[model samples]
Target: MDSSDREVRDVNNILFGGFTELFCLFLFLVSAFFPNSLLAGDLVEQWTGKHTRIAWVQDQGNGLDTYGRSPDLMLYGYDSQDGRGARPLLTQKSNFFKPLITP
Candidate 1:
């Protein structure tokens, strides 16, 4: 019916939607509020559990890790790139929807 009835229905809709939105926001922001929580750790737990290792690499500020036990026990992230890092070129000027350049 009337204008007052429509306004009350709209207010009910907003109140219900506001509570749902607040719940979703709480779920999204719980991690930021509590930095030490493990909410998504299970997503990677299986892979990390299978490949994780517990070893000590001796570091004495000499620019080298002394995992000198065996050659197969080499460390990672130390392979140099000759000072020029990875530079990827984007070959696609546009996607299926829109062009990347406006001009």
Candidate 2:
């Protein structure tokens, strides 16, 4: 209606939208840590498919440059590029999307 009313509405909209987004993000991060133990065997099998093990590698040090120094278990049959046998390297990138350039 009035200018002041419109401004109030805009502010409320922004606040509510930001809160909703932050809430959703929090839920997503929390869910990531909480494994679905109730998941059925068939469902889990379907998602896992041929791959049985999923290995996650985290950077021990800070900074992007530390990525090179990160532990590489490729020699242990956990490499996507040089992956051998039944289990492949289960990096975060490979799990979600196919790598553009793999060795």
Candidate 3:
């Protein structure tokens, strides 16, 4: 109504808008770092006797097309990086680790 009241309202609106924008940006940033906790199904049984780590990367769309639907690349190797009888084992892509995994 009055000039003073209008000025105060405008300032309040500006502050609110800025806060909303900041909160949204913060949430976006947080989500970028969040892990994709969802997996298609249980591969635990298939993982028997194999020592591996499953890395779930959250898609921040940072210029790389991480083929999300593609099968996970399983890298099998010795338990130790460099030690006695420690060596990186390579497997064929098609019949992969059939000899290693199977007894």
The candidate that achieves the highest TM-score relative to the unseen native structure:
2
Candidate 2 residue pairs that clash: none
lDDT of each: 0.33, 0.36, 0.34
Which parts of model 3 have CA positions greater than 4 angstroms off? 1-12, 36-103
**Per-residue alpha-carbon lDDT of candidate 3 for residues 1-103, written as tens digits (9 for 90 to 100):** 5797688668867867686456335433433443221111112213333332222223233424233322333333322112212122443222222222223
Q: Evaluate residue 46 in candidate 1 and report its C-alpha lDDT on the 0 to 100 scale.
A: 44
Cα lDDT of candidate 1 equals 0.33
Q: Give each model's clash number.
A: 0, 0, 0
RMSD per model, one decimal: 23.3, 14.4, 20.6
**Candidate 1 residue-wise lDDT, 50-82, digit = tens:** 322121222223434222322222222110112
Candidate No. with top lDDT: 2
Sort the predicted structures by TM-score, highest score first: 2, 3, 1
